[model samples]
Target: MTGDTMRGAARAVLVGPWSARTWQACAHLLAGFPLGLLTCFTVVLLGGVTTGLLVTFAPALVTLAALLWCVRGYTALQRDRFATLLGVVIDPPAHCREEPGRVRRLLAEAAEPGTWRQFCYHLLAGPLGVVGFVVTTVLWTVSTMCALVSCYAWALPADSAFGRHLHTPSMVIELTVGGLLVFHLAPFVTVGLAAADTWLARTLLGPTDIDRLRSQLVSVTQSRNAVLAAADAERSRIERDLHDGTQQRLTALAINLGIARQTLPDLSGPAREVIEQAHEETKQVIAELRGFVRGLHPAVLSDRGLDAALSGVVARSPVRVRLSVDVSERPSPTVESVAYFVVSEALTNISKHAEVGAAEVTVARNGATLRLVIADAGRGGADEGGGTGLRGLTHRVASVGGSFRCDSPVGGGTTIEVELPCES
Candidate 1:
C-alpha cells in the first residue's frame, strides 16, 4: 500500500472510534460535575438541618423524605447516563412497600439499602466528578493546543525566549513531536477517567447482585403462583364438566336400565335375566363414575371445607385411620386442594407400599398456615424418586408456596408432613 493510505488506515484503526468515545466521555464527566456539586450542596444542607430538628419535631421527617426522594432521582439519572454512554446495564433497586402508618412508612423508606446507597453516591459524586472533569479537560486542552502549534508559531516573536534559542526547523520538529505525543495520549487519559466514573456509577447507582437475585426470585414466585391459579381453574372446570355432563348421563342410563328391569315380565326367562344383569352393570358403572369425579375434585371439599373432605378420604382408606382435623376457618380452594391431595396420596402410598395395618392423619390450621401430617405404622423406606405420586405431591405443594417433608426411615413408620399457606 502507498504511504498516505497506510497512514490513513492506521489513524482510522487507532484513533477513529476511540477518539470519539474519549470526547463523549469527557463531555459526560464535565456535564456531571456541576450536577454533582449541586446535589452535594443540597443534600448536605438538608441533612444537617434535618438532623438537628429530628430531636424535637416529628415534621422534620418530611424534610428527610424529600431529600431521599431527590437523591433517588439523581441516582436514576446517573444510571441512565451509564447505560447510554458506557453500555452498562444496571437495574434500579426494588421499591419498598409503604407501611400503614405515615411515620412507619417514612422510617421504612429511609432504612432501604438503595436509599443509603444513593445518599453515599451523592456525597461522593462531587469529589469524583471534580477529579474526572479536571483530568479530562486538561488532557483535551493540552492535546488540541499542541496539535495546532504550527498555526500559532508565527505569533511568537524572534526576541522571545522560545524563538531566540530554537531555530525554525528545530522548533517545528519539536512542536510536531510534542503534538503527536499529546494527541495520541489524550484518548487513553480520557478513557481512564471515564472508566473511573463508570466504576463509581456501577457501585453506587445500581442494585447489587443480591438485590437482582431477589428480584428474579420474586418474579419467579409470581409466575409460579399464576401457573398454579390457572391449573386450579382448569381442574375446577373439568370437575364441573364431569359432574354436569358425563356423570349426569351415566346416572340417567342407570335409571333407564332400572326402569326397564322393573317393566320386563318375569315370564320372559332368559331375556329377564339379561335385563337384570345389564341393570346391575349400569349401576356399577355409575358408582365408578362418581368415584372418578370425586377424585378429580371432590364436591364435599368445595361445599364443606377441608375437614369434611379429608374425612371422606380417611373413610375410604383401606387401612385403619385415626383422623383428627381442627380447622376453624376455611382456607382458599387452592390450599385446600393441595392439602387434600397430599393426604390422599400419602394414604394411598401407605396402603400400597407401607404394608401398614393402621395410619394416623392430622390436619390443623395455625394462623395463616395449614398443616397436614400423615403417619403410618408400617415398615417405611419411602422415597420421592421411587414413585411419581410423591413427586407430583411435592410439586403441587410447592406451587402454592407450601412445603412437603417426608421422614420415613428404614423399618420405621413413615411420616409425611405438609405446610400450606392459606393466603389467596
Candidate 2:
C-alpha cells in the first residue's frame, strides 16, 4: 500500500466511533475504580455518626454530606462519560430543586429511604473499583517486569518474587509465557470491570417510581403556570377583538341611528322610514354585542361568585342540567373561574357532541380540593383532546393545578370530572 493509504487506514482504525469509545471507557474505568472505592469508604465511615460534637460527630456529619456531594458530582461525571464512551444513559438523583435552605433541604433529602440505599451502593462500588484497579495495575506491572528479562542476564532461574511463586523451571521461559498472557488479559479484565461499573451505576442510581413522580409533579406545576398564562392571553385577545371589531361597529351604528332619528323630521319620504328601520336594527346589534362580551368572560364570575355564575350557565343550557353545589365558601379566582369554565365547556360539549337529553353538574368543596362532576346521557367518547373547545378547557383547568378527565363510551354517555385545589 502507498504511505498515504496506510496512514489513512491507521487513522480510520484509531478514530472510529466505537473504537474511540471503547478506548476511553477502558481508561475511565481503570482510573475511576480507585476513586469510586475511596468515595465508598468515605461514605461508610461518615454514615456511622449519631451525634455532632464539633470534633467528633460534627465533622463526621459534615464529611458525610461532603462525600455525598462528591458522589453526586461523580455520578454526573459518570453519566457524561458513559453516554459518550458507551452510548448509554445514566442519571443522578434529582434533589436540586427544593428551595433556598440548602443544609435543611440536603438533610431532609438524605433522610429519605433511597438516600441510605444509594449510600450503601456507593460504599460497595468503591471496594469493587479499588480491587479492579489493583488487578489491572499489577497485571501491567508484572508483564512489564517479565518483558525486561531479555535485557537482564539474570535469567535468575525462577528466583523473582512472582517467578518463584509460579514455580516454573526457568525464569526466562516463565517470563516469555506470562508476559504474553498478562499483556493481553489485563486489558480484558479492565474492560469487564468497566462494563460492571456501568451496570452498577445504572441499577443503583436510576430514579424510583416515587422519585419519577415527584419530578413529574414539578413539571406539572410548571405546565399549570403556562396554561394559566395562555388562558390570560386568550382572554386578552378576545377582549381586544370585541372592543375593536364588534364594540366599535355597535358604537358607530348607535351614533348613526341617533343622527337619523334627529333628521327624520325633515324627511317624510321612503328614506325616513328606511332610516327608522335601520335604527331599530342597530339597537338589536348593540344588545347582541353586549351579550356576546358578557358570555366571553362574565363579571359575575367574580362578583356574585362561581356558584351563581354556574347556576346561570346551567339555566341557559339547552339540555336540562341539574346543578348541585355545596361550595358555600369561595375559592381563589383562578380556581373558581377554571371550575366554572370546565363545567360550562363540558356541558357545551355534551350538548353539541354527546347528543344527550339531560346533564348534571355537581360542585362541592372536599378538603383542599374543589371536586366537580359533569355527567350527561350523551354518546360517550370524551377525551382531553376531544376537540378544540375541550382541549382549551383542559388547559384552563390545568392552569390552576387542576386535572380534567373525560369518560365517554360510544352509544353510552359522557362524564367530565375535574379536581382543583381550592384556596381562598
- Could you say which candidate leads in TM-score? 1
Q: Give the range of the ten consecutive residues with the poorest summed lDDT in model 2.
A: 13-22
Q: At residue 372, what lDDT does model 2 achieve?
A: 94
Cα-based lDDT at residue 355, candidate 2 = 74
TM-score of each: 0.85, 0.65
State the lDDT of candidate 2 residue by residue for 1-424, as single tens digits: 9999999875654343235554565666676686676766666665545334336745656765776676676567657666776677876665644646867676776676656656666777677767766876787678767766666634445455543633344656767767756665555566677788777777776676787899898788767667665675577468668967888987898888889788669787787888888888888887787667656666677678878888888887888999999987788666776787788778777778877679888999988889999898876876656463778877777667688887777767877788998852
Q: Measured by TM-score, how close is model 1 to the native structure?
A: 0.85
Error of 1 at 312 (Å): 3.3
On a 0 to 100 scale, what is the lDDT of residue 205 in model 1? 73
Q: What's the lDDT for all of these models? A: 0.81, 0.71
Q: How does candidate 2 score on lDDT?
A: 0.71
Q: Write one digit per residue (lDDT tens) for candidate 1, span 1-424.
A: 9999999877854683356687677777887788778778878888887898888676588788878778878877877777777676677766777799977887888888877877888888888778877877777677667667677777756555644533376775776678677777767677777787777777777778887798889899778778777887788789899889988887888888788888756547888788788889888987887778777788889889888888898888898999999999888888888888888888888899998799999999999999999998789888889973788989888888889998989999888899999884
